[model samples]
Target: MASLNVGGLGGYLREQRRTAQLSLRQLADAAGVSNPYLSQIERGLRKPSAEILQQIAKALRISAETLYVQAGILDERDRGEVETRGVILADPTLDERQKQVLLQIYESFRKGNGYGADDGPAGEGGTSSAGTADAS
Candidate 1:
Protein backbone atom coordinates (compact mmCIF):
# COMPACT_ATOMS: atom_id res chain seq x y z
CA MET A 1 0.00 0.00 0.00
CA ALA A 2 1.20 3.49 -0.72
CA SER A 3 1.62 6.00 2.03
CA LEU A 4 -1.37 8.35 2.34
CA ASN A 5 -1.29 11.77 0.69
CA VAL A 6 -2.69 13.71 3.63
CA GLY A 7 -1.82 17.09 2.15
CA GLY A 8 -3.56 16.25 -1.09
CA LEU A 9 -6.64 15.07 0.76
CA GLY A 10 -6.71 18.30 2.76
CA GLY A 11 -6.46 20.43 -0.38
CA TYR A 12 -9.20 18.46 -2.08
CA LEU A 13 -11.48 18.78 0.94
CA ARG A 14 -10.86 22.51 1.09
CA GLU A 15 -11.62 22.85 -2.59
CA GLN A 16 -14.82 20.85 -2.26
CA ARG A 17 -15.91 22.94 0.71
CA ARG A 18 -15.34 26.11 -1.26
CA THR A 19 -17.23 24.75 -4.24
CA ALA A 20 -20.16 23.90 -1.99
CA GLN A 21 -20.07 27.48 -0.62
CA LEU A 22 -19.90 26.17 2.91
CA SER A 23 -17.90 27.93 5.57
CA LEU A 24 -15.41 25.83 7.52
CA ARG A 25 -17.65 25.91 10.58
CA GLN A 26 -20.70 24.96 8.58
CA LEU A 27 -18.92 22.03 7.08
CA ALA A 28 -17.57 20.97 10.45
CA ASP A 29 -21.06 21.16 11.90
CA ALA A 30 -22.48 19.19 9.01
CA ALA A 31 -19.79 16.57 9.31
CA GLY A 32 -20.06 16.37 13.11
CA VAL A 33 -16.52 17.61 13.59
CA SER A 34 -15.05 20.40 15.66
CA ASN A 35 -14.19 23.60 13.82
CA PRO A 36 -10.58 23.51 14.87
CA TYR A 37 -10.28 19.83 14.03
CA LEU A 38 -11.76 20.34 10.59
CA SER A 39 -9.43 23.28 10.13
CA GLN A 40 -6.51 21.09 11.07
CA ILE A 41 -7.67 18.56 8.53
CA GLU A 42 -7.84 21.34 5.98
CA ARG A 43 -4.35 22.39 7.01
CA GLY A 44 -3.03 18.82 6.70
CA LEU A 45 -2.08 18.52 10.35
CA ARG A 46 -4.20 15.47 11.20
CA LYS A 47 -4.91 12.15 9.60
CA PRO A 48 -8.64 11.64 9.85
CA SER A 49 -10.20 8.30 10.54
CA ALA A 50 -12.29 6.56 7.91
CA GLU A 51 -15.50 7.46 9.75
CA ILE A 52 -14.55 11.12 9.63
CA LEU A 53 -13.88 10.77 5.92
CA GLN A 54 -17.32 9.23 5.43
CA GLN A 55 -18.98 12.01 7.40
CA ILE A 56 -17.20 14.65 5.38
CA ALA A 57 -18.06 12.93 2.12
CA LYS A 58 -21.73 12.79 3.10
CA ALA A 59 -21.75 16.39 4.22
CA LEU A 60 -20.15 17.46 0.95
CA ARG A 61 -22.61 15.39 -1.10
CA ILE A 62 -19.68 13.62 -2.78
CA SER A 63 -19.05 9.94 -3.22
CA ALA A 64 -16.92 8.42 -0.51
CA GLU A 65 -15.10 6.37 -3.14
CA THR A 66 -13.62 9.51 -4.64
CA LEU A 67 -12.56 10.77 -1.24
CA TYR A 68 -11.06 7.39 -0.41
CA VAL A 69 -9.04 7.47 -3.58
CA GLN A 70 -7.86 10.99 -2.82
CA ALA A 71 -6.88 9.92 0.69
CA GLY A 72 -4.89 6.98 -0.73
CA ILE A 73 -7.08 4.58 1.23
CA LEU A 74 -8.32 3.20 -2.05
CA ASP A 75 -6.51 2.59 -5.33
CA GLU A 76 -7.76 4.78 -8.15
CA ARG A 77 -7.12 2.16 -10.84
CA ASP A 78 -8.80 -0.75 -9.07
CA ARG A 79 -11.18 -2.01 -11.76
CA GLY A 80 -13.07 -4.85 -10.12
CA GLU A 81 -15.81 -2.66 -8.70
CA VAL A 82 -15.97 -0.74 -11.99
CA GLU A 83 -16.24 -3.97 -13.91
CA THR A 84 -19.09 -5.15 -11.71
CA ARG A 85 -21.00 -1.95 -12.32
CA GLY A 86 -20.33 -2.19 -16.03
CA VAL A 87 -21.54 -5.75 -16.15
CA ILE A 88 -24.77 -4.80 -14.45
CA LEU A 89 -25.31 -1.93 -16.85
CA ALA A 90 -24.46 -4.08 -19.86
CA ASP A 91 -26.98 -6.79 -19.10
CA PRO A 92 -29.61 -6.53 -21.80
CA THR A 93 -32.28 -8.41 -19.88
CA LEU A 94 -32.32 -5.81 -17.15
CA ASP A 95 -33.83 -2.42 -17.70
CA GLU A 96 -31.84 0.63 -16.71
CA ARG A 97 -33.94 1.14 -13.60
CA GLN A 98 -33.45 -2.41 -12.49
CA LYS A 99 -29.76 -2.13 -13.11
CA GLN A 100 -29.61 1.00 -11.01
CA VAL A 101 -31.47 -0.65 -8.16
CA LEU A 102 -29.19 -3.64 -8.28
CA LEU A 103 -26.16 -1.38 -8.27
CA GLN A 104 -27.45 0.48 -5.24
CA ILE A 105 -28.05 -2.77 -3.37
CA TYR A 106 -24.58 -3.98 -4.30
CA GLU A 107 -23.07 -0.74 -3.03
CA SER A 108 -24.98 -0.92 0.24
CA PHE A 109 -23.66 -4.41 0.90
CA ARG A 110 -20.16 -3.25 0.02
CA LYS A 111 -20.40 -0.29 2.39
CA GLY A 112 -21.73 -2.46 5.18
CA ASN A 113 -18.81 -4.81 4.74
CA GLY A 114 -16.22 -2.08 4.36
CA TYR A 115 -15.23 -3.16 0.85
CA GLY A 116 -13.41 -0.62 -1.25
CA ALA A 117 -12.36 -0.05 -4.85
CA ASP A 118 -9.93 -2.94 -4.76
CA ASP A 119 -10.78 -6.63 -4.66
CA GLY A 120 -7.44 -8.14 -4.01
CA PRO A 121 -7.08 -11.84 -3.39
CA ALA A 122 -9.09 -12.71 -0.35
CA GLY A 123 -7.20 -13.99 2.66
CA GLU A 124 -8.17 -17.36 4.10
CA GLY A 125 -9.72 -15.65 7.09
CA GLY A 126 -11.54 -13.13 4.95
CA THR A 127 -14.29 -14.15 2.58
CA SER A 128 -14.97 -12.37 -0.67
CA SER A 129 -18.36 -10.67 -0.83
CA ALA A 130 -19.67 -13.36 -3.14
CA GLY A 131 -18.54 -16.09 -0.81
CA THR A 132 -20.09 -14.37 2.13
CA ALA A 133 -23.37 -14.06 0.29
CA ASP A 134 -23.31 -17.70 -0.75
CA ALA A 135 -22.57 -18.82 2.78
CA SER A 136 -25.48 -16.84 4.09
Candidate 2:
Protein backbone atom coordinates (compact mmCIF):
# COMPACT_ATOMS: atom_id res chain seq x y z
CA MET A 1 0.00 0.00 0.00
CA ALA A 2 1.19 3.51 -0.74
CA SER A 3 1.45 6.16 1.89
CA LEU A 4 -1.10 8.95 1.90
CA ASN A 5 -0.30 11.79 -0.48
CA VAL A 6 -1.89 14.73 1.25
CA GLY A 7 -0.53 17.36 -1.09
CA GLY A 8 -1.55 15.46 -4.18
CA LEU A 9 -4.99 14.81 -2.82
CA GLY A 10 -5.44 18.43 -1.81
CA GLY A 11 -4.34 19.66 -5.19
CA TYR A 12 -6.68 17.26 -6.91
CA LEU A 13 -9.59 18.40 -4.80
CA ARG A 14 -8.80 22.07 -5.45
CA GLU A 15 -8.55 21.47 -9.14
CA GLN A 16 -11.82 19.61 -9.25
CA ARG A 17 -13.56 22.29 -7.26
CA ARG A 18 -12.30 24.99 -9.58
CA THR A 19 -13.24 22.98 -12.63
CA ALA A 20 -16.74 22.69 -11.28
CA GLN A 21 -16.85 26.52 -11.05
CA LEU A 22 -17.80 26.29 -7.41
CA SER A 23 -16.76 28.64 -4.70
CA LEU A 24 -15.26 27.33 -1.52
CA ARG A 25 -18.35 28.15 0.45
CA GLN A 26 -20.59 26.56 -2.16
CA LEU A 27 -18.67 23.30 -2.16
CA ALA A 28 -18.51 23.29 1.57
CA ASP A 29 -22.26 23.77 1.76
CA ALA A 30 -22.85 21.04 -0.78
CA ALA A 31 -20.50 18.66 0.98
CA GLY A 32 -21.91 19.51 4.40
CA VAL A 33 -18.54 20.65 5.69
CA SER A 34 -17.51 24.00 7.07
CA ASN A 35 -15.82 26.37 4.67
CA PRO A 36 -12.72 26.69 6.82
CA TYR A 37 -12.46 22.93 7.11
CA LEU A 38 -12.69 22.52 3.36
CA SER A 39 -10.11 25.25 2.97
CA GLN A 40 -7.84 23.36 5.34
CA ILE A 41 -8.34 20.26 3.26
CA GLU A 42 -7.54 22.09 0.03
CA ARG A 43 -4.45 23.56 1.66
CA GLY A 44 -3.16 20.11 2.68
CA LEU A 45 -3.38 21.04 6.32
CA ARG A 46 -5.93 18.33 7.13
CA LYS A 47 -6.76 14.83 6.09
CA PRO A 48 -10.39 14.17 5.38
CA SER A 49 -12.13 10.98 6.27
CA ALA A 50 -13.50 8.65 3.64
CA GLU A 51 -17.00 9.88 4.32
CA ILE A 52 -16.00 13.50 3.85
CA LEU A 53 -14.17 12.58 0.68
CA GLN A 54 -17.26 10.87 -0.62
CA GLN A 55 -19.39 13.88 0.17
CA ILE A 56 -16.97 16.19 -1.60
CA ALA A 57 -16.78 13.88 -4.57
CA LYS A 58 -20.55 13.88 -4.77
CA ALA A 59 -20.61 17.66 -4.69
CA LEU A 60 -18.00 17.79 -7.42
CA ARG A 61 -19.83 15.24 -9.56
CA ILE A 62 -16.85 12.90 -9.63
CA SER A 63 -16.21 9.37 -8.49
CA ALA A 64 -15.32 8.84 -4.86
CA GLU A 65 -12.93 6.10 -5.92
CA THR A 66 -10.91 8.72 -7.81
CA LEU A 67 -10.39 10.73 -4.62
CA TYR A 68 -9.62 7.56 -2.70
CA VAL A 69 -6.97 6.61 -5.24
CA GLN A 70 -5.49 10.12 -5.24
CA ALA A 71 -5.30 10.08 -1.46
CA GLY A 72 -3.63 6.66 -1.53
CA ILE A 73 -6.41 5.41 0.66
CA LEU A 74 -6.98 2.60 -1.80
CA ASP A 75 -4.44 0.51 -3.58
CA GLU A 76 -4.82 1.06 -7.31
CA ARG A 77 -5.33 -2.33 -8.87
CA ASP A 78 -4.55 -1.08 -12.38
CA ARG A 79 -1.89 1.56 -12.53
CA GLY A 80 -1.69 1.26 -16.31
CA GLU A 81 -5.36 2.03 -16.66
CA VAL A 82 -4.98 5.06 -14.45
CA GLU A 83 -1.96 6.23 -16.38
CA THR A 84 -3.73 5.78 -19.67
CA ARG A 85 -6.65 7.79 -18.38
CA GLY A 86 -4.35 10.52 -17.14
CA VAL A 87 -2.68 10.74 -20.52
CA ILE A 88 -5.98 10.97 -22.30
CA LEU A 89 -7.27 13.60 -19.93
CA ALA A 90 -4.08 15.61 -20.15
CA ASP A 91 -4.17 15.75 -23.93
CA PRO A 92 -4.88 19.35 -24.90
CA THR A 93 -5.77 18.41 -28.46
CA LEU A 94 -8.71 16.29 -27.41
CA ASP A 95 -11.97 17.81 -26.34
CA GLU A 96 -14.01 16.49 -23.45
CA ARG A 97 -16.23 14.33 -25.64
CA GLN A 98 -13.25 13.02 -27.56
CA LYS A 99 -11.44 12.15 -24.36
CA GLN A 100 -14.52 10.39 -23.05
CA VAL A 101 -14.89 8.39 -26.23
CA LEU A 102 -11.26 7.37 -26.22
CA LEU A 103 -11.40 6.35 -22.60
CA GLN A 104 -14.55 4.33 -23.22
CA ILE A 105 -12.95 2.48 -26.08
CA TYR A 106 -9.77 1.84 -24.14
CA GLU A 107 -11.66 0.50 -21.14
CA SER A 108 -13.80 -1.68 -23.35
CA PHE A 109 -10.76 -3.19 -24.99
CA ARG A 110 -9.11 -3.81 -21.66
CA LYS A 111 -12.23 -5.41 -20.24
CA GLY A 112 -12.95 -7.55 -23.30
CA ASN A 113 -9.38 -8.83 -23.35
CA GLY A 114 -9.05 -9.30 -19.57
CA TYR A 115 -6.03 -7.02 -19.54
CA GLY A 116 -4.97 -5.46 -16.28
CA ALA A 117 -1.94 -3.70 -14.86
CA ASP A 118 -0.33 -7.01 -13.92
CA ASP A 119 -1.74 -8.88 -16.90
CA GLY A 120 -0.18 -8.36 -20.32
CA PRO A 121 -2.20 -8.75 -23.49
CA ALA A 122 -1.34 -12.44 -23.66
CA GLY A 123 -2.44 -13.19 -20.15
CA GLU A 124 -3.85 -16.55 -19.09
CA GLY A 125 -3.28 -18.65 -22.18
CA GLY A 126 -4.52 -15.89 -24.47
CA THR A 127 -2.39 -14.79 -27.40
CA SER A 128 -2.08 -11.16 -28.44
CA SER A 129 -1.80 -10.55 -32.16
CA ALA A 130 -1.98 -6.81 -31.81
CA GLY A 131 1.18 -6.10 -33.77
CA THR A 132 1.07 -9.08 -36.12
CA ALA A 133 -0.66 -9.36 -39.45
CA ASP A 134 -0.58 -11.98 -42.21
CA ALA A 135 0.49 -10.95 -45.68
CA SER A 136 -1.56 -12.63 -48.30
Candidate 3:
Protein backbone atom coordinates (compact mmCIF):
# COMPACT_ATOMS: atom_id res chain seq x y z
CA MET A 1 0.00 0.00 0.00
CA ALA A 2 1.49 3.26 -1.11
CA SER A 3 0.37 6.84 -1.16
CA LEU A 4 -1.25 7.48 -4.52
CA ASN A 5 0.23 10.11 -6.80
CA VAL A 6 -2.02 12.59 -8.57
CA GLY A 7 -0.40 11.78 -11.90
CA GLY A 8 -0.95 8.12 -11.25
CA LEU A 9 -4.57 8.77 -10.45
CA GLY A 10 -5.07 10.67 -13.65
CA GLY A 11 -3.44 7.90 -15.64
CA TYR A 12 -5.46 5.22 -13.89
CA LEU A 13 -8.73 7.00 -14.49
CA ARG A 14 -7.92 7.44 -18.15
CA GLU A 15 -7.01 3.79 -18.44
CA GLN A 16 -10.11 2.66 -16.58
CA ARG A 17 -12.33 4.75 -18.81
CA ARG A 18 -10.63 3.26 -21.84
CA THR A 19 -10.88 -0.26 -20.53
CA ALA A 20 -14.58 0.24 -19.94
CA GLN A 21 -14.94 1.07 -23.65
CA LEU A 22 -15.94 4.60 -22.90
CA SER A 23 -15.05 7.56 -25.01
CA LEU A 24 -14.03 10.80 -23.37
CA ARG A 25 -17.38 12.27 -24.32
CA GLN A 26 -19.24 9.33 -22.83
CA LEU A 27 -17.28 9.37 -19.58
CA ALA A 28 -17.61 13.13 -19.37
CA ASP A 29 -21.35 12.83 -19.81
CA ALA A 30 -21.50 10.20 -17.12
CA ALA A 31 -19.28 12.22 -14.80
CA GLY A 32 -21.23 15.39 -15.57
CA VAL A 33 -18.14 17.23 -16.69
CA SER A 34 -17.43 18.90 -19.95
CA ASN A 35 -15.73 16.56 -22.41
CA PRO A 36 -12.85 18.98 -22.89
CA TYR A 37 -12.31 19.26 -19.16
CA LEU A 38 -12.41 15.53 -18.68
CA SER A 39 -9.95 15.15 -21.52
CA GLN A 40 -7.68 17.68 -19.91
CA ILE A 41 -7.86 15.89 -16.60
CA GLU A 42 -7.13 12.61 -18.30
CA ARG A 43 -4.17 14.18 -20.02
CA GLY A 44 -2.73 15.33 -16.69
CA LEU A 45 -3.21 18.96 -17.64
CA ARG A 46 -5.77 19.48 -14.88
CA LYS A 47 -6.52 18.18 -11.44
CA PRO A 48 -10.09 17.53 -10.40
CA SER A 49 -11.35 18.69 -7.05
CA ALA A 50 -12.67 16.15 -4.58
CA GLU A 51 -16.27 17.06 -5.41
CA ILE A 52 -15.61 16.60 -9.09
CA LEU A 53 -13.95 13.31 -8.31
CA GLN A 54 -17.05 12.20 -6.47
CA GLN A 55 -19.22 13.11 -9.41
CA ILE A 56 -16.84 11.30 -11.73
CA ALA A 57 -16.97 8.25 -9.50
CA LYS A 58 -20.76 8.32 -9.61
CA ALA A 59 -20.70 8.53 -13.37
CA LEU A 60 -18.21 5.66 -13.58
CA ARG A 61 -20.42 3.65 -11.20
CA ILE A 62 -17.45 3.20 -8.93
CA SER A 63 -16.84 4.31 -5.37
CA ALA A 64 -15.52 7.76 -4.68
CA GLU A 65 -12.74 6.04 -2.82
CA THR A 66 -11.46 4.86 -6.15
CA LEU A 67 -11.27 8.42 -7.32
CA TYR A 68 -9.58 9.36 -4.08
CA VAL A 69 -6.98 6.75 -4.70
CA GLN A 70 -6.48 8.13 -8.17
CA ALA A 71 -6.37 11.72 -6.92
CA GLY A 72 -3.69 10.83 -4.36
CA ILE A 73 -6.02 11.91 -1.58
CA LEU A 74 -5.97 8.46 0.08
CA ASP A 75 -3.79 5.43 0.34
CA GLU A 76 -4.97 1.88 -0.01
CA ARG A 77 -5.52 1.70 3.74
CA ASP A 78 -7.88 4.61 3.51
CA ARG A 79 -9.98 3.05 0.80
CA GLY A 80 -13.47 2.93 2.30
CA GLU A 81 -14.69 0.81 -0.57
CA VAL A 82 -13.58 -0.21 -4.08
CA GLU A 83 -11.58 -3.38 -4.28
CA THR A 84 -8.62 -3.27 -6.67
CA ARG A 85 -8.43 -6.69 -8.19
CA GLY A 86 -7.33 -5.15 -11.46
CA VAL A 87 -4.06 -4.07 -9.90
CA ILE A 88 -3.00 -7.66 -9.81
CA LEU A 89 -4.22 -8.25 -13.30
CA ALA A 90 -2.21 -5.35 -14.63
CA ASP A 91 1.13 -6.99 -14.11
CA PRO A 92 3.25 -6.61 -17.23
CA THR A 93 3.94 -10.32 -17.27
CA LEU A 94 0.27 -11.01 -17.86
CA ASP A 95 -0.93 -11.08 -21.43
CA GLU A 96 -4.28 -9.66 -22.41
CA ARG A 97 -5.91 -13.12 -22.29
CA GLN A 98 -4.47 -13.79 -18.88
CA LYS A 99 -5.70 -10.45 -17.65
CA GLN A 100 -9.16 -11.25 -18.92
CA VAL A 101 -9.20 -14.65 -17.23
CA LEU A 102 -7.94 -13.27 -13.96
CA LEU A 103 -10.46 -10.46 -14.09
CA GLN A 104 -13.24 -12.97 -14.67
CA ILE A 105 -12.11 -15.12 -11.80
CA TYR A 106 -11.79 -12.14 -9.56
CA GLU A 107 -15.26 -10.95 -10.47
CA SER A 108 -16.71 -14.38 -9.82
CA PHE A 109 -15.02 -14.52 -6.45
CA ARG A 110 -16.42 -11.12 -5.63
CA LYS A 111 -19.92 -12.31 -6.47
CA GLY A 112 -19.59 -15.52 -4.49
CA ASN A 113 -18.30 -13.63 -1.50
CA GLY A 114 -21.26 -11.25 -1.39
CA TYR A 115 -19.19 -8.34 -2.56
CA GLY A 116 -20.87 -5.38 -4.17
CA ALA A 117 -19.89 -4.23 -7.62
CA ASP A 118 -18.13 -1.14 -6.27
CA ASP A 119 -16.95 -2.23 -2.83
CA GLY A 120 -16.07 -5.84 -3.28
CA PRO A 121 -13.54 -7.81 -1.34
CA ALA A 122 -10.49 -8.83 -3.38
CA GLY A 123 -8.94 -12.30 -3.68
CA GLU A 124 -10.06 -15.70 -4.74
CA GLY A 125 -9.53 -17.01 -1.21
CA GLY A 126 -9.39 -13.81 0.74
CA THR A 127 -5.62 -13.97 0.69
CA SER A 128 -2.59 -13.06 -1.38
CA SER A 129 0.50 -14.98 -2.37
CA ALA A 130 3.83 -13.58 -3.31
CA GLY A 131 4.81 -16.56 -5.41
CA THR A 132 4.61 -16.24 -9.14
CA ALA A 133 1.86 -18.16 -10.86
CA ASP A 134 3.95 -18.46 -14.00
CA ALA A 135 7.62 -19.20 -14.20
CA SER A 136 8.07 -17.20 -17.36
Query: What tens digits encode model 3's per-residue C-alpha lDDT throughout 61-101?
Result: 77788788777776554363234554655589988898777
lDDT at 54, model 1: 89
Best by lDDT: 2
Candidates arranged by TM-score, highest first: 1, 2, 3
Off by over 4 Å in 1: 79-136
TM-score of each: 0.62, 0.57, 0.53
Cα error, residue 90 of model 2, in Å, equals 29
By lDDT, highest first, what's the ranking? 2, 1, 3
Q: List runs of model 3 lying over 4 Å from the truth.
A: 1-4, 80-136
> What is the RMSD of candidate 3?
12.0
Model 3 TM-score, all chains together: 0.53
lDDT (CA) per prediction: 0.80, 0.80, 0.69
Q: Could you give candidate 2's per-residue lDDT for residues 1-136 as a string of tens digits?
A: 5688888999999999999999999999999999999999999999898899989999999877789898888656554576678889999999999998887677666645655433445655445543432211
* Cα lDDT of model 1 by residue, 46-79, tens digit: 8988789989999999877778788888667454
